[model samples]
Target: MAFLIKRGSKKYPYITARVRAMKSKLMPREVYPKLMNMDIPEITRLMGESEYKQDVDELAQKYSGLDLLEHALNQNLARTYRKLLRISKDEPNYLITEYLRHWDIWNIKTILRGKYYGAPAQEIMDAVVAAGQLGYRQITSIANMESIEDIKSALANSPYYSAIADYEGGELSTIENELDKIYYSRLLASIGKSKGEKLSLKFIMTEIDLKNLKTLFRTKKAGLDKDVILELLIPGGMELKSRDLKKMSSLSWSDFLKRLEDYSYWSAISEVVSEDMTSLMDVEAVLDKYAIEYASKVSHYYPISILPIYDYMLRKNNEINSIRTIVRGKKVNLPDEIIRKHLVM
Candidate 1:
């Protein structure tokens, strides 16, 4: 259970108003499909007309096609997140800072995965976003490091050190899982007790619940037994308690589906989920859609508080993600319907 430390908030009015102005510029869900039909050059032309125009133009002489777009998008994301830290103060600052550590943890996971698979440093670097506490230079340096032990030594004093300390190049999933648990636990520990805190808490807990649900789907699909699956579940969700997860994990596949119907999330997954289903990909997408919709819906209630700020951040992040998905999907000649299905919004 997460609570908050009491503190007087400052300048949510200014920050909220500013973010509202920025939100107006985000591409709506409808805009993504149109881009799916566009080629890389066409999409680049489209990007040239948006807020990314300057970035696209400035990098045009140096790079073109997908290369140009990817670099521009990464630069914009880093700038946007940095601006959030610069503009907000007090509790909002604390909240945003902690939450953005998600990028650092994500970058770390990408690095570990890359190294484990012997991917080149440049390939690993391409996957990292310098939007968190670690700056571009630091992440670059870590990417170039010789070994996991070397990386661990560099991060020794940081919050994430413990999450990876025990790893001796074992299953990277174990380390990834620990990174997630540590991230949320640290975030909940740092949250403050303001009027807006409960909303933030709800957002975080819902994230945990959804993450656990995705884990549940994957584990069950792989035919993992109850005890193993329970070991994999994260604690501290809004609902779907450990005991509940245990009970569901122990049930027969059909009984597990029956048990899930009692939860609010069941409605979103009902049609796509069944004992005969061979894939949980569609079910997982519904959960992701629910998370996006839930974040946007609850944000309106606390207009001048941290809720809008949080929503704006996620919206901005998701827009670029959708854009990338379309561009990449088209480049690979994936079917239009397949691209649409992969889109989160």
Candidate 2:
């Protein structure tokens, strides 16, 4: 990822027109099923004919199997996101840059988790997608640091360093959650008095609702204590208020299902929230489906705004994740039915 060189004009009408064209080039939803039926080599051959061709071809001689697929996917994802920042101008660029910082948060969490799990620095860099304010050079330096404190010191001048404070190296999840809260909090804070900005705020709040919903589902499924779940939930959701979430978090698994009926998202998760389930994959996939589908639906209503860019970003990410999920599942010989259930499309 490269730095913003020249600040171009704030042309939503112009930028959005280009975004539509780029979005149209994204892999279609129907293609995933076909890819599922094919082998790795077959999938690679297929992807070679699509947008990922350059990435696959360039790495084809150096890697094979899952390695080949993962590298290609990560490279493409990083390049694709960086391209958005490169192409966007002025206000569009700012909004896109701010939104893309989520990837930076993701990279940070990946580093912390990798180190906590005793993973090597090289392994850590494999998962680091430098598509945000932090480029590959900065990320590489942080990943190779001797300790978390080293990372904190390296990031002291940045806005996200606060997330690393008060760390005792125990619950990395807590630090990860703090980083997320900071991202959404800072993003919400950045939205100003413009009508377009208000719509963006509403969109982000809705995302927070979905994110908080995922957190609740994971924690609740684990039968974690209410306070623990409450601590993990971020504030400022559009509908999933913190107080309401607190009350819901206090319920048992069965009672949690009953409580969910009071909210609008219940229909999306009801089928997968049964008391007998062992995994939360279905519920999470449904939530992802809800988010991307909702974004796609609402974006057309506000075409010449940040919403279209927002929608494209989510869809692009889903493309990478969905492809990876399928490829990884197939490589490990996971059951097709189980793999399909986890797919967002």
Candidate 3:
């Protein structure tokens, strides 16, 4: 709806300038190497001097150790993303807002899972990233709900409500799958009427292709019916078609690999599948890396578009995951090599 403002050829100098400055301030790859070796306090101290200073300082008293690190990271990510939303107005802002809505889907799913597992409200609250369309109060209220049904009711007005409410069973997977579908479906649908926007089209198509490939591999492994797989598939992928997926579904595992050989993701998928890996974790990591790389490239071409903000969001999420992986690995004293393998970077 924000795309109703058609200021074609208008230069968003203010927004683009601000974003460029922020992009320059992101922690460099070299910084990660140094941080990886620092103790918790040292990590905190180092971060205090960076853009994360205010967040780290604000959260320091109440939380220490991993809690402190996580809170600061989440807060910083939220602040950075919210800044982008504030600076961007009109069409660009709308696209960024739509993408950030994924965080709402994320928060909803996290709350539902937490309630289903009977996790304490505080624990659920800690896991949420308040960087989406959902207001802080809404997330807090949802987090405090005692029952999964209450959580569902709280989300009745959310974009996910329609899709999630359609599930007949109380299974958490049903809700989760619906959430995933809604996120992707909305993402594809929000490309606006700007069929000429190359950057936007590329971002959506690449995302769809990555997701479709993941779904195909997982459904094949689970020995699910082709119809069910198709049901799970999001439309509008650049390379994947319903017919291609159907054909792939009928082939033997080896034959399926052969079929995918000519596809763009074939190399990555081939490596994982050939090893007889049952866990889709590695495949997911490969996809994450690829997605990041793709976004980075798009940002280079369309710096003023929503691509950079989305790239930054993806990188921030990856950074948190990478840090968590490192911290947990160090806590358990896993070999650095093993920990490195687990990281998406």
TM-score rank, highest first? 1, 2, 3
lDDT for 288 (candidate 2): 94
Model 2 misplaced regions, further than 4 Å: 1-10
Question: Comparing candidate 1 with candidate 3, which one achieves the higher lDDT?
Answer: 1
lDDT of 3 by residue, 1-345 (tens): 557555543445667677777767777777766766877778778878888899989998999887887888877777877888887777778777877888898888888777767788888878788889997788999899776567668788788898667543356766677777788778777776663245676787878889888877788878788677777777777887667766876776667767888788776656666636667777877887889988888788876666776677788778777877777777778887777777887
lDDT of each: 0.86, 0.87, 0.76
For model 2, residues 1-345, the per-residue Cα lDDT tens digits are: 233533222478877888899999988888988988999999988888899999999989988888888888988999988998888777778888888899899998998888889899888987888899999999999999978789888888878988897775766878898999999999999888666677788899999999988888888888899898998999999988878888888988888878888888988788778888888888889999999988888898888788988998899899999999999999899999988988888
> Per-candidate TM vs. native?
0.93, 0.92, 0.88
Residue pair clashes in candidate 2: none
For every candidate structure, what is the RMSD over all alpha carbons to the true structure, in angstroms?
3.6, 4.4, 3.4
Candidate 2 accuracy as TM-score: 0.92
lDDT of 1 by residue, 1-345 (tens): 223323344668889899999999888667787888788999999999998988888889988888889878887888899999999887788888988999999999999999899889988987788999999999999999979899999889889999899987857988888898899889888777677776788889888899999988888878898888887888888888777877877887788888899999998888889899987779877888888788888878778788888888888888888888888888889999888887888
Which ranges in model 1 have alpha carbons more than 4 Å from their true place?
A: 1-9
| Top candidate (lDDT) | 2
RMSD of 2: 4.4
The better-scoring model by TM-score among 1 and 3 is 1
Clashes of 2: 0
At residue 75, give the lDDT of candidate 1.
Answer: 74
**Candidate 3 C-alpha error for residue 343, in Å:** 2.2
